[model samples]
Target: MRPSRGLLLFLLANLLLIGLLLHSVFTLLTLLFEDCSNDAIPAIDIPAPDALEEINKLPQYIPKIIHQTWANESIPEKWQKAQKSCRDLHEDYEYMLWTNEKARNFIAKEYDWFLETYDNYPYPIMRADAIRYFILNHYGGIYIDLDDGCERRLDPLLSYHAWLRKTTPSGISNDAMGSVPNHPFFKSVLDSLQKYNRNWQIPYVTVMYNTGPLFLSVIWKEYLPTVKSEETRVRILMPAEYNDHPWSFFGVYKGSSWHRNDAKTIFWMGQHWLLVTVVVFAFCASLYVCGFYAYRRVHLRDSNYSAHASPFSSWSWPWSKNGYKPIKHEV
Candidate 1:
C-alpha cells in the first residue's frame, strides 16, 4: 500500500528538524573548541641576572628613550608627572617623545601600509596603542604608557633585546615595553597586526584583541618557538617586577577611564569549555530523541488505524473532557 500524504509530510518534517538539530550541534561544538581562551599561550620564563646588577650592564647601541603620546603641548598633569619621573631617573638619556602628528607622519613615511590601517581604525586609542609597536620596531627603545610612572630606573630592562611586562588577571601587558631596533619579535608583531585586527563588538574586547595586551600576548606566544638561544629571546617582566611599590620598576596610575566591563564581559565557554560541550551535546541529543519519538507516535498511530474506523473511533484525545469514546462508523 502507498504511504499517505500525511505520513510523507510528517517524515519530511522530522527529517528537516533532525537536520537542523545536527547542524546546530556541530556549530556549537566548533565554537566551543575554537574559543580563544582555550588557546591562551603559556608564559615563558627568561633567565635573568640580578635586577640591580643588570642595570649597570646596559647595551650601548640601544636608544635611551622613545615614548609616545597623542597629546601635543597640553599634556595631562598626571602623565606629565609620569614623564618627569622617568627624566628624573635618567637625565642623560635622549628622550624623543612623539606627539600624535609626528607619530602619524613617521608611520606614513616608513610603514605606509600600517599607516593606512592606523588612520582607518574604528577607535582612536587603538591607533595610539598600535603605533608604539612600529616605533619600537624601528627605533628600539623603551615605550611606556603615559600613566606608568617610573618607580625606579629602567636601565636594567634595556639590557634585553626585547621585553614585555606581565599584567594582572592574566597574560602580558603592552603598557610598558622595551626592544632593540628590528627585533624579530616586534617585526612579527607589526606584520601580524593586520591579520589579528578583529572587531569583537565590545569596545574593551575589540581594543584588547586588536592593539592592547591580548594582541601582544598572542604574538609573543607565536614568536617563542623562533628563539634559538637565550640571548635573542624576548624577556617578560613578571607582575612582581613591573608593578607599584619600591621593589617594582614602574607605578601604574589609574589612567584608563574609557573601557568598562559589565556582566557581558564574561565568556561562558572560555573556562571549562570541554565540560560545557559535553553538557550541551547531551541536552541537544535528548531534545532530538524526544522530538523524533513524538513525531513517530503521532504518524504511526494515524497510519495503523483501520480504514473504516472514524478518526476518534480507536484513539482518544488525552486532554479531552469526554475521553476514550468509540464512535460508530457507517458501513
Candidate 2:
C-alpha cells in the first residue's frame, strides 16, 4: 500500500536517526576493543634474583656498540673499529643483533649512505620492526640503542621487571625495553609491531628509532596528557637512569663527533612525514563527507531525483514540491 506523505517523512527521519546511532555504536566498539585479542600470551621466566644481582655487580661499564648491515658490507668492519673506541672507555659489549626484518630494511632505506660509505659496521642490516620478533622467536634477549649507551648495569631494570609494570604515574616507556623468553607483554609488543609493519614501511621504522628516546621527553615536559589507563605490563624506568630527550648530558660538549646534523635532519623529516600523511588523510575524508552532503542538497531536492535514478538517489526528498528541500531527517 502507498504510504501517506507524513508517515513517509517520519519513516525517513527514523531511518536517519537509526543510522547515526548505529555508526556511533560501532565507532565506540572499535575504540574500546579493536586491537584486543584473547590469544594466549606466552609465559616468560624472570631472571633469577641472585644471578641478576651478581651480573649487576660484575661491571657497570659497557662499551657502546652499533650494529648495521649495508649494501657495502664494509660497515660491519667500521662498526668493529667504533666498538673498539667504546671498549677503550669500558668493557666491550658485543654489537646488538637486529632481529627485526624491518630494522634491516630501515637501515637500507634510511641510512643507505651509512651502509654504502661506512665500512666495518658491527650489526647486519635488519628491519627494526622485525628486531623484537627475531629476538623473541630465535633467542630471548634485549636490544639497546648505541646512542643511549649506559655505563651503569641494567640488572636493576631486569630484576625489577618480574612482569611488565607501569612506567610512570600512568604510562610505560618503550625505550630500554626487554622481554623474557616468552612473556605476554613481549609477545604483545611484537604483535603490535607486526601489525604496524604490515601497514606502514618507512614511517614505522622512524618510530622504532626513538620509541624510547621521545618517552624521555614526556618525563620532563608531559607532552601527551594521559594514555588510557586500562592496559598492563607497560613499564618505565626512573628518569635519572633512563635519560630522555631535551635532557642535556652534562660535560658533553657541542660538536662531540657523536652529534651529526644530518642525523637530526633525517629524524625531523620522519616526524614531518607522519604528520603530513595524517593531515592529508583527514582532509580527504572531510572533503568526501562535505561533497556528499552538497550532492544530497542539490539532486535530492529536485524532481529529477528519483528512487530509481541511481544508488545515490537516497538523498531524493519526494514530499517537497520544489524537490530541493533540506533533509531534516537527522541521523
Candidate 3:
C-alpha cells in the first residue's frame, strides 16, 4: 500500500530537523576551534623608545604622501580639490597620487609575489584597499583616501610610529592610516592578506573581508595583545579627535560610490550566526514533532481499520455488532 501524504511529510520533516541540528552542532564546534587556535599563537611585540614624548615630530618620520585614484586624469574635480587640500597643508611632503598603472608598477617592483593575487582581485576598490597596507609596509608614510580632505597639517598625527583612526559602530577605519616604514603591525596586515583573502560572492563583502576596513580591523585586533608597551602599541585616534567638526583634521566627503552597504552587508553585520542557527533548529524540530503527531494519528486509524476488517479479527466496535440497540430513553 502507498504511504499517506502525512507519512511522507513526517519523514521529510524529520530529515530537515536532523540536518539543522547537525549544522548547529558543527557551527559551535568550528567557533570553539577557532577561539582556541587564536589563543595558541604567540603574540609579537615591537619596542618604540620615547614614543610618548615625540608628539608633533613629523620631520623624524618619512615625509612621503600617498593616495590612490583610478587614474590621474580620471580623478573627479571634487576629489582633485580634496587632494589639493593635502598639498596646501603640507607643502614639504612628497605627495604621490598613484593611478592604476603607477600602483601596479610600484607593487610589481616592490612586492612581486603579491601581484598574482592583486591582479586577480575581482574589484578595483579591493586592489586599492590592499595596496595601501603593502605600501606602508615597504615605504612608511601616510596613506589617505581620495575622498578625505585635509583640514590641517597631518604633522601632529605623524608623531606616533603608527596610528589608526576609529570609526562608527566599532572597529578602526582604514581611510586614514599612518605608519613608519616596516611597522610590525602593518607587516602583519600584509602577511595576513592572502590568508584572509576570501570571495564572499557579494562585492561589498568580498572587498570588506579581503582588504577593506574589516580586514584591517581583524589584523589590528590580533596585533593589540602583542604590544608589550605603550610605545609599541598602535595609537587609535577617536572619531572626536580626528573629525569632530567641519574644520577637523580630516574633512570627509560623502559622495563616494565605491563603498556602500547592502542587504547582505546588513545581514552579516548583525552577526547572529549562532543565534540564527539555534532558532532554525528549534523551528524545524517543532515542525517535525507536529508532523510525527499527525502521522501517528493517521497510522492508528489505519491500524484500527485493518484489525476490524481482517477475517481472523478478534476485536470489534461495540456499536458495530448486529442487533446492538439502546433500550434506554432520554436523559
Best by TM-score: 1
Q: TM-scores of the models, in the given order?
A: 0.66, 0.41, 0.64
Pairs of residues clashing in candidate 1: none
lDDT of 3 by residue, 1-331 (tens): 3555655776886788688877744533333223222212111121122333443333455445654455554778778788788888778887777778888998899999999999999888888888788777777889888888887666666656778876654466788888888888998898999997878888777887789886787677767678876456687766655665543578877644675566455557447656766788688778766866575555555555452332213433356665222222234
For candidate 2, which ten residues in a row score worst on lDDT?
A: 247-256
Residues forming the 10-long window of minimal summed lDDT in candidate 1: 38-47
Off by over 4 Å in 1: 1-54, 57-61, 260-331
- C-alpha lDDT of candidate 3 relative to the true structure: 0.68
- Which parts of model 3 have CA positions greater than 4 angstroms off? 1-59, 62-66, 260-331
Angstrom error of the Cα, residue 151, model 1: value is 1.4
Give the Cα error of residue 188 in candidate 1, in Å.
0.6
The TM-score that candidate 1 achieves is 0.66
- The candidate that wins on lDDT is 1
lDDT of 1 at 244: 47
lDDT tens readout by residue for model 1, 1-331:
3545654776698688778877744533443332233222222221233455544654544578757565575778767788788878878776777788888999999999887788878887888888899888888889988788887777666657777776644467788888889988888999989997878887877887788876777777666668887556877776666764456778877587446663233444445556766897698778767875576466545545555443434444468767555433455
The residue ranges of model 2 lying beyond 4 angstroms of the native Cα positions read 1-126, 136-138, 162-175, 191-194, 199-234, 244-289, 304-331
The superposed Cα distance between candidate 1 and the true structure at residue 181, in angstroms, equals: 0.2
